[model samples]
Target: MKYLVTGTAGFIGFHVALYLLNRGESVVGVDNINDYYDVNLKYQRLAECGIDRGNVSDNKKAVSSKYPEYSFYKMDLADKAVLMDIFEKEKIDVVINLAAQAGVRYSLTNPDAYITANIQSFLNILEACRAYPVKHLVYASSSSVYGANTKMPFSTSDNIDHPVSLYAATKKSNELMAHTYSHLFNIPTTGLRFFTVYGPWGRPDMALFLFIQAIEKGQPIQVFNHGKMKRDFTYIDDIVEGIIRVADRPAKPNPEWTGQDPDPGSSYAPFKVYNIGNSQPVELMDYIGALEKAMGKEAIKNMLPLQPGDVPSTYADVTDLKRDTGYQPQTSVEDGVAKFVAWYKKSYGK
Candidate 1:
């Protein structure tokens, strides 16, 4: 099967592309390679896919030496014409749209970025899917969509109407947009609500990365909510597995779905939402402890109140995902943190 994976240079996207490529599947990957974090890390991910960063051009294709079946392009999903053209040319069977303007705190500072990348770009993707009619379209959603809901172990069935941040709102918007497409065009769409995903080649802005960096540099690591937060920190590999499984299976109309009492997770239309998480929530302090162990260093702590647009806790109830795709996040915080620190050391030449 030929798959088109957006944000191939991203943490999750890179892992997903690698997984598919390792399975001997043909993949057409795309990424804008924005400077949201470090473009060098993005380039390094491309390098791992055997894409020569020196040869990269706008919308230009590059082949992978390690996985000859894999090819990549430097493109933004916001470019409707280019995205549509790629869809038409690639004859893409499945699309895993991971590209987006990520970061909740950043959204507060730069709302336009969220509007352009998350909202506008997603509309383009939806339109492309509607026009081209792919078998399955799996896009990245977030646990943040749960927003102000204080419910423990958030279920997909729960209403995600109250979003705390623009980023969360945009993700929720993607789900709604996808549902509309599924309803109107009969396009199968699956949205995966990812939790705090962390592993090798993770994003620098994320908690794990920041904590590691601060600890290594002997700088103070900010502990939000005074280390009173709990998160369903999932491994990247597990998230990728769930994504691939869902992508392989096109969403089907829920047979039991009724207009009288609609299920938010499933619909009469070919649309579904699943929470891809560890099902285990870890405390912020415990996570920090794990990080300290991994790095063998003590962190200079700066405990602070929860930032605006930030949640105190996030726990995903992935029962539906397990039922549908046999998805389970196996990596514990201890194991996961050790692996990340190991990768960080090697990647940074420490």
Candidate 2:
């Protein structure tokens, strides 16, 4: 099947595109390649896909140098006209929208970026899907949508009404908007709420990346929540596998749906939400220790309170994911961190 994957330059997107390309599927990739992180890193990822850095500018198609079945374009989802043009040309069968302005702390200062990237961009993708019918649409949501909820092992069945940050609110909004399209247009849509995803080619802004960086430099790592926070850190390969599995099966309506007692996670429409996580919560201190073990360096620590727009813990209940897609995250923190450290050392020639 032909696939259109947005955010192809980003971490998870890069890994997702590679997986699909290796499986002998044609993929059309798009990313604005904004300087949210290192644009050089983004370009390097595209280079691995055989897309020359000089060959791409913006909104222009660049064919892969190695994989003839794969091509990429520099574009933003908020640009509806250009997006529509791609849909017109490619006749995409399935879409995996992973592009977003991702950061919880950054959202506090730049709320507009969140709205523009998360809300407006997602709306355009939904509308484009309506204009060009596809078999399925799998979009990236976040575990942050579970904000302000103290529930252990966050289940999709739980109502996430109190979002602590604008970022979380935007993700929750995507799920709502997707449900609307699914109900009205009969579009099969699945929202995968990713939990603390990290691995090789992972974003530099994430905790694992940060901790590793500081420890390597012999700098003091800022331990948030005084090292009390817990996160369900799933490996990149596991996350990509879950996405493919969930996307292959277009969402279906729950047969036993009732309006009087509706489920937030599912509706009578072809819409569903699932948490794709390791289902294993690790403490911040333990995670840091794992990094130190892998790096063979001790990190100077500075304790800090839990900042606003932050949750103390996150543990995903991926029961539905396993039941529906046979997904089981296999990477442990030690193994995952070791791989990441190895990649970091090689990628930087450290």
Candidate 3:
């Protein structure tokens, strides 16, 4: 079966595409290649996937030299016409929509980006799926949607009506939009609420990447919430595994679902949401300690108050995901940090 994996230039998207290709699955990847962080890193990721930077342009297909079954297109999902062309041409069986305007802090200053990249793009994707039906549509949501809920181990069933940041709000909107599509169009949609994912080839904007880069350079690392912040620091491999597993299982209506008492996670329609996290929250300081141990360098620290649109902690309850997909996140902070550091050193020659 052919899969269309959006956000191929991003960390998770790149990893997912490569994993599918390695397994001999036909995969088509698309990304706007936006310069949210560093376009070079994005290009490098594409190059690693055997799509030459020079060969990529808008709405053009660049087949991978490394993997025969893999192809990539540099395109924005907001462009419905071009996106529809892809859906019509490729006969995409499944779609893993990972593209979005990522970053809680960035969303604060640039709310329009969130609207364009996250909301508009997602709507176009849904429209394309509606026009050309797919067996499954798995997309990325975030634990950030558990905003202001002091509840430990955030569950899928919890009410996510409040989102602290525009980024989180957009993710919540995606879930709502997906549910509507599932209801109206009979689409099978599954949303995965990813926690703090980190590992090799991770996004430079992420805490893990920033902390490690600063420590390696002997610079001060910003400790948000004055080191009180905690995250379910899930490994990239674990996340990719969960995505594949969930994608393989098309969502089915919850037989026990009732409108009298609605479930936010599942519905009578073919729609489901699951949290894919490590289920272990690690303190910010402890995560830094792991980075230090891996890099053999101490980081100068800068204690900072909790920034706006930031949560003090995030813990995921993966019971539903485990029950449904047999998904188990296996990497601890230490091992994941070590793997990232090793990759950073090799990639950057640090």
Candidate 4:
């Protein structure tokens, strides 16, 4: 089957594409490669897929040498014309949309970016899927959507109406838009609400990468909420595995779904939502200690108040995912951090 995987230059997308390629599946990867963080890191990821960084230009297409069945294109989902063209040409069987303007704090400063990338771009993707009916449409949601909820082990069945950040709001909107498509056109849509995903080749903007960089440079690492934060730090490999499993299984209508007693997780249409997370919440201090162990250096700490649009803790209830896909996030924080540190040292020649 031919897959169209967006955000090919991103950490998760790169890993997912590599996994599919290794399994001898054909993939047409797409990315705008925006300079949201480090463009060099994005280029490095593309290079791993055998795409020459020098050869990539706006809207250009290239093939990978490492995996002959894999190809890539520099395109934005907001560009409906280009997106539609690709869909028409590639004859894509399945689509995995992972591209977006991703930082919560950044959204506070640049709200328009989220509107264009997350909202507009996502609508374009939905339209394309409607026009060219694919087998399945799998997209990324966030645990941030559970904003303002103090519930333990956040569940898909919980209400996500009160989002603390614009970024989170957009993700919730994506879920709504997906449900509309599924209801209107019978498109098989699945939304995966990812928790704190971290591992090798991770985004520099993420906490794990920032902490590792600061600790390595002997700089003080900022501890938000006075180190009272807790997260379900899921490993990248586990996330990719869950994604592939879901991609293979198209969503089915919930026969028991009724307007009287509605479950937010499923619908009468072919729409579903699942929490893809470690299902284990670790304290912030413990995560830092694990990083210190991996780097062999104690980090100078700078305790600070929690910033706006930030949640103190996040714990996911991945019961639905496990029930459906037999999914289990097996990587422990210690092992995951060690693997990330090793990759960081090797990548930067520290």
lDDT of each prediction vs. the true structure?
0.92, 0.94, 0.94, 0.95
**Collision count for each candidate, in order:** 0, 0, 0, 0
**Per-residue lDDT tens digits of candidate 4, residues 1-350?**
99999999998999999999999999999999998989999999999999998888888789887888988999888999999999999999999999999999999999999999999999999999999999999999999999999989899999989999999999999999999999999999999999999999999999988998898788999999999999999999999999999999999999999999899999999999999999999999999999999888999999999999999999999988999998988899999999999999999999
Q: After superposing candidate 4, which stretches have Cα over 4 Å from the reference?
A: none
For 68-149, candidate 2 gives per-residue lDDT tens digits of 9899999989999999999999999999999999999999999999999999999999999999999999999999999899
TM-scores of the models, in the order given:
0.99, 0.99, 0.99, 0.99
Worst 10 residues of 3 by lDDT: 209-218
Pairs of colliding residues, candidate 1:
none
Candidate 1 structure quality by residue, lDDT tens digits, 1-350:
99999999999999999999989899999999999999999999989989988879998888887788888889888889999998888999999999999999999999999999999999999898888889999999999999999978799989889999999999999999999999999999999999999999999999988888888889999999999999999988888889998998899999999989889999999999999999999999999999998888989999999999999999989888898888877789899989999999998987
Superior candidate under lDDT, 1 versus 3: 3
Error of 1 at 99 (Å): 0.4
**Predicted structure 3: lDDT:** 0.94
Weakest 10 consecutive residues of candidate 4 by summed lDDT:
52-61
lDDT of 1 at 207: 92
Name the regions of candidate 3 deviating beyond 4 angstroms. Answer: none
Give per-residue CA lDDT, model 3, range 76-111, as digits (tens).
999999999999999999999999999999998999
